[model samples]
Target: MAGGMFIFSAVDTQAKFLTDTLHPFQIVWFRQLGLVLGLVFMLSYHGASILRTAAPGLQVLRGAVAAGSATLFIFAVSYVPLADAVAVTFVAPFMVTLMGALILREPVGMRRWTAVIIGFLATLIIIRPGTGAIHPAAFLVILAAALFAVRQIVSRALAGSDNTMTTVAYTALVSVALLSVPLPFVWQWPTEGWQIALLISMALMAALAETLVIKALELAQAVVVAPLHYTILIWSTFYGWLIFGDLPDLWTWVGAAIITATGIYTLNRERLAARKPPQT
Candidate 1:
């Protein structure tokens, strides 16, 4: 899963590259459109049965938030370094912790909450609020992470009711709808071979990366799966340096390490807390 996640950064980098040639809306649209095709094939085995009683509203809400989150994240990556844009996404794990306590009424012990706060502190390290090093575009990533957290919360609510396949399918349909709405304003033909290559690159990576993520989760515990979060920093850093000639500053690394540590600790703590002290 970690390895798969490392490849996922390619989607971010490629989307940012393509954003120079295509709108985030168009890039996102192609991504979801490709995913929708992949999802249809996966759902073929289930026939119409997969359409049973999952919470459609929550699913659609998640789709919209994910659409917006992805759109904003890509938009920010165009202005910020790839690694820096990705570092700000560390906010999602922390926000998910808070959302679980507030929205799901899940019991969170003091230690876990402290870890959450520390995680946010890490995000601040990257942004450096008082300094001008942070781009205003960074806020877009922050908001994206926040909405993504809410989407994850909604996922928890609907977990057993829908399989991962159903969620993936919903993502395809709804994100496509969400991303397509702005096509009229941003649509343009690819006039250059480089532009065509960029779109194809973005869509292909987005489809493969997301599909592999779903597969990765099936093979491991979500908590066990969480550490893959840090792999994004590693991959993003490479892409930032190699493709864009942008290297993250010290604060970005500091924040990423802190956030990665806190996120890991919190996941372990949550797993420990979920235990029910074995039935007598």
Candidate 2:
């Protein structure tokens, strides 16, 4: 997860820089293109059976949601500082916890509920809507985080029906297809050689990061490694400072700390809950 987060941060940094020249939609489409093509090659060489999924409709829906979440975050980062955008996105885990209670009918204790509320309030501290401290586009990060939560919910639902690779492959293919619809309209092919190189580099790095993260989850309990998700904030801050000369203000740091604390507490609670013996 650590390696994945660092690479993912680099991918996002590249995407944000590309947004200066390319539309977010186009940037994301290109990012997914490499994965899609690789998946297609594997399918062709192996067999069509490799693409089989028990829940095709859900897979497609997940892909669409994933595409929207990625695009919105990339778009938001174009206006919101990288660290601010990443800090706001930490709300996704809390949203997932809230959605698990509401949508999955999972029981959420009062303490976890309070933590969720505080997590969102901490988000407001980062964005500070009324104060105009951050761009309105920051709200898009919240919307993106909500969509990300939805993706997690769908993944949980599909866990029994599909393996991780099937879901990932479908997401890549579907995202490429969906984004292609708007590609022609917003598309501006990279004008310089470096821009083209960054596009390919971003796509490869994203695929690598996704693989590392999945592998990490496979080897470690989610609760044990979940805290590593916050490490992206560190990388994002470094990249933001080194590349854009931007840093999160005092309030952003404070908000991030509260959110991280609440998230870690919630995860620790979950770990404890899982350890409890089954009721008679």
Full-model lDDT for every candidate: 0.79, 0.87
Model 2 spans > 4 angstroms off: 218-221
Query: Candidate 2 at residue 34, lDDT?
Result: 70
Clashing pairs in 1: none
lDDT of 1 by residue, 225-262 (tens): 76777788888889888988999898788898898889
Best by TM-score: 2
Candidate number of the best lDDT: 2
Q: How much does candidate 2 score in TM-score?
A: 0.94
- Tens-digit lDDT track for model 2 on 1-280? 8998999999999999999888999989888877776677767876676579999999999889989999999999999999999999999889888887888787789999899999999999999988999999999999999998787667666767776677778888888899999888997867899999999999988877765765666566666777899999999999999999999999999999999999999888878877889999
Candidate 1 regions off by >4 Å? Answer: 43-53, 278-280
